[model samples]
Target: MTLPAVLRSAAYPYRANSLNLFRLILAAAVLFAHSWYIAGRGTGPSLQGENLGGWAVAGFFVLSGFLITRSRLRSTPGDYLLHRVARIYPAFVVVLVVTAAVFAPIALLVETGSLQGYLTTPVTPLQYMWGNLPLEIQHYNIGATLQSVPYPGAWNGSLWTLFYEFLCYLVVWVLGFLAVVRRSPVVVGALFLVSVAVYAALGVAQRGGLDESFALFARLLPFFLGGSAVFYLVERWGTNLIFGVASLAAAVGLIAAIPHWGGQVAAPCLAYGLLSLSAVIPQPGWIAKNDISYGFYIYAWPVQQLTVLFGGAQWGMIVYLAITVVVTAAFAWLSWVLVERPVMLAIRERRAKGSTRSEQLPGDIQPAAGT
Candidate 1:
């Protein structure tokens, strides 16, 4: 059968596309946005009261939701959970270790002239790495290592979102196991609606009291759900340029009209529009082959802090950003090459070995991917 103008399955296949390039851009955008703060200026500029980094993160959630949902629907429960853990935890664990052992010590040596008293500090390097091993950022600084930096105490400010992102993953997992996503996506769509309602109720909830984590979850949940909605819609209707444009127009209007929360409400359209765009845009072979966006994001803040320790804060925003791009990109490349890709490839190979051709689905759809 001839496909629609463009097949959603084709645009959002498990691998190979401009999505990687888009993710790279988003990751760098975070680095660029954070340069101001790392250099002691402040949040440089923002849209609708959210910083550029914040918007980039929201964009990440939208894409992740779509991609991760696809992952769940296509894999076994055990395999899906393992892939999620392997994808997120190993690199995260590596970054934490690097921040604590390498960067923090360097920060101490630069500040106090020795790593002599380091182990006796309040939260020692081991403690710092161990405390946050679970993805929840329980420790933001290794003792007093980052206290002198411009942002002060937060070594990896970008890390807090990982906890929320994992939670979103688990949420999708639970929904997938119940057949809610594949069988009754309208319920998934409704969850997005409820999250949006919570978004509208946030101001009132803050005055009346509400958990910060839940509030943050409410903020990101719609985007994730919207992504899931987009996946289903695209699968059902395929992609059309006109619909993509119209969806983007609607998303833009919501984003402009609503203040801080409009983007969450606009997520499905935004995700669809962007995914549709991805169908048309061709990605570079280099970026399409290797995904370092996750590494770039996780490593950026600490690298920036190190840059500050060496007096990068005085170099001005442009210089700081330039240096950061080079250093962080290198780290990201190493992460994909050394840790993330190898670990994932190993796990994928193991799973493939365990499965047989008879068990495969007729039109087995592949996940787009987040990390």
Candidate 2:
């Protein structure tokens, strides 16, 4: 086929796109952005006042909003909640525990040469697990474990984002429950515009009675909504070469021109731009099938912290980053294979069985054994 025909084709399977690879790249971006801090080098890079990790996170939220909105729409409320909970919670809890028990203790013993008062320390291992189990990171360090590092006292900087990410999920849940997402495009569009307007009016900071976290949420909301808008917008207009080019151009222009609010404003277009790219970009078969991005993300900061403790950062940026990636990827793989995948697979198996039973119902229920 011709280039024009290829560009026009939306033949990429929407359900099985390489968006996971996009997410993996974003995850890697976060690690790269954080490397400077881990290496005691300071902030790595920035654009439009947001760092690489920040932009990657926005991409994450945007992609999540698109996919999660789609998931919510097709699923029952119970199923939606269950799927969301299962997808995020298990790995999260496991990570919290592993950090407190495994990573923190190792750091503590290396730092002080003993775990002698480890359990009773403020934000103890138990505290770390229980404190963050609710999906909010109430404590950063576990027992003075990170005092000697450059970015001291923070065991895991990455986990904090998970809180906001899950909050975004809850927002979708509420919208789904209210039937707002299904009712009208006008309402959702207007809501998105209003959010953008507020974000533009507020800039990067928040005012009024809104607490910091909620204010931060307001800032992030536009990206999520922008992603949601993409789902509907794409459903209505479809993705093609012209659409892809136009959106990509719009994304670049808006993100570059708008300042402070550019990312939030250009979010839908950015998401679509990436989606278009994903269609053309082929991910490896391994990564395409198993999504270890979440695993990669959750473990990166802590793994970097561990690396720093072990003097890995002294090897310079390239070596440090390679070590962090290699170690974190292993942890991510374990988390995926051992924790995340099993829960999700179980959920799928349960769903399949339920579907089978439902299909075999009414007549198939026929009074059991000749009753």
Which candidate wins on lDDT?
Answer: 1
Looking at model 1, residue 353 earns an lDDT score of 85
Clashes of each: 0, 0
Candidate 1's residue-wise lDDT over 1-371, tens digit each? Answer: 77564432443443434777778788888888888877888788888887888778877888888778777787888777887788888888899888887888889888888788687787878888888988788888777677777788788888888888889889988998685568767888999998899888898888787888778878888888898878787766666666778888998899889987799999999888877777667888887778878888988988888898898768677788888899999999999999988987797578778972222221111212222
TM-score of each: 0.91, 0.90
How would you encode candidate 2's per-residue C-alpha lDDT over 216-294 as one tens digit per residue? 6777888878888887876665566567678879977988898878888888888787777776678889987677788
For each candidate in the order shown, give its overall lDDT on alpha carbons: 0.78, 0.77
TM-score of 2: 0.90
| Cα shift from native, residue 318, model 1 (Å) | 1.4
> Candidate 2 deviates by what RMSD?
7.5
In candidate 1, the residue pairs with backbone N, CA or C atoms under 3 Å apart (3 or more residues apart, or in different chains) clash, namely none
lDDT: worst 10-residue window of model 2: 362-371
